[model samples]
Target: MATRDDGAGAWYHRGQVCCTNRKLDEALACYDKALELSPDNPLLWRRKGFALIKAGRYAEATVCFDRALAIDPDDATAWQRRGYALACMGRKEGAVACFDQALARDPEHILAWQSRGWLLGTLCRYDEAAACYETVLRIDPDRGSAAWHRERMRERRDLAALASEVREAERFMEVPACIREVVRERDYGNAELARAVLREMVGQAERPAVQHR
Candidate 1:
């Protein structure tokens, strides 16, 4: 690390101050100055990437993150930030992969879990998404966003599962009446004792489907 006496350190501090003040362009300038003095500094590269992301220069931010990762592959925060940049650019699959990389290095990374959950939800992988949010809630029980999203994902997953079961039931009903009778008699009850079990199943499933809408 550069000492306070070094020009690079001074510049890096200035960049941090600017970033804290939301002066992203000025922060980028200071980071560039620091990088000029210490081009091999991965921290400087990552800081620049964060400034670019704040500016909505996602493509440039990704390039800076790429440079940072090339310098140090084990940086979980850099990987997570890179995923965020990719997500901003609409590269969702790429973002998810980057989040996976971050989690591989640090399973307790809350932001990575949250971001992955959001992406999975967008992709309609509700069960997996809900699992991610469940992990987030376990790690930080006060995370209201994660808690809210978890419930939403669970509802969606349940609806999807129920719909699939209903479809299977419909298909089963379409089978030969002989087969249906056998199934009904074996699993449900004899016709003398059964009260239209298959119809009841379909009706229950369809009720939820209607409520989901």
Candidate 2:
């Protein structure tokens, strides 16, 4: 494997480091540099879009995700992010459509399932929301929050708030442990899940990749 430590790969990996450190502006710059070297790389666009999402630039993020999908239409991550961007923009229907498309491409996508479930619940579509939660439970029974989602559905919370929460949780999962803890103080999280997420993030960051996690 060609590690990002070598050649043009350096830029991408550095960008990932910046992202992990929550330096989104710097991360975007690094990604842009890498894109200059590898214009066709969908992962670069996806990662850049992720940074844009964190920065609350939903429109720009959606454009980046669109570029990613253009290069690889079946990329479920891009589709999921497109959905997230739409949700951030308060476009509920479009967000749901994008989430549905993501799930279609990757039925096992846990985040997509959760997102769709939460959205459906907010819209008073209890049956569909329950179905989504059921899918999530079937896929990962160990998900402790699965049960709470049903309760959440009953509460009929704001979809926008739910969207923000999901996005924050996801971003938290991507951050380095040191920074994650700091961010966690202000965000809701489970200790075990955070540890698990940190492990995954660390593992991915340490892997040899010309792109990034």
Candidate 3:
């Protein structure tokens, strides 16, 4: 129902009202009309991108975000939304990079931090992911989801460390045949040298024993 007399801003406002009412298709039409009138407007591109996201057209949404960013490279929200669209497409590393761009522009961007942490967590980079959650909690202490994620990452990190320690302990517990040779030397009367080698093997001569109370 928009006429040639309607200005681009008028069409943009109509799109906003349509979006508020959940009429995504109508919103997209209005936005398209607005874009035709003012294709260089970064806000119109970003708004269309958000509407595309709500319509579950993530791939198209990314294109819209790309256009917005091309027009205004410093748009932190556009970068964040591009990352979110990439995430929905299962392109995690790409999504992380976009989120990183957003955070670079606006360090206190909570959504970027949360999304980056989520992607890192899925990648099993628990320590880095935990650090992201810790940053979020520092920025907003009452964020329960970030707190919960931080605890989970901490647990996973501890479990990874414990697993590594267990592997190391298992390796040390494997008795080498060199010990048997040392025992044989002791039996052959080179007892002092054998004891010295045995002490070296156990690291007892170089390391002090723990004092018991």
**How do the predictions measure up, each by TM-score?**
0.73, 0.69, 0.70
Candidates 1 and 3, the one with greater lDDT? 1
lDDT of 2 by residue, 138-200 (tens): 999988787689655533433333334445556534554543553445333343354455556
C-alpha RMSD in Å of predicted model 2 compared with the true structure: 20.5
Question: Per-residue alpha-carbon lDDT of model 1 for 1-213, expressed as tens digits?
Answer: 656339998999999999999999899999999999988888999999999999999999999999999999999989999999999899999999999999999999999999999889888899899999999999999999999999888766654544454457766444335435544344322332222444565677678779999
Ranking of all predicted structures according to TM-score, beginning with the best and ending with the worst? 1, 3, 2
Residue-wise lDDT of candidate 3 within 164-193, one digit each (tens)? Answer: 433443455543455454343333333334
Clashing residue pairs for model 2: none
Give me the displacement of residue 172 in model 3, in angstroms.
8.7
Determine which window of 10 residues in candidate 2 has minimal summed lDDT: 154-163
Clashing pairs in 3: none
Task: Give the whole-model CA lDDT for all candidates, comma-separated.
Answer: 0.83, 0.78, 0.82
At residue 156, give the lDDT of candidate 2.
40
Which runs of model 2 end up more than 4 angstroms from their true locations? 1-6, 155-213
**How much is the lDDT of residue 152 in candidate 3?**
81
lDDT of 2 at 104: 92
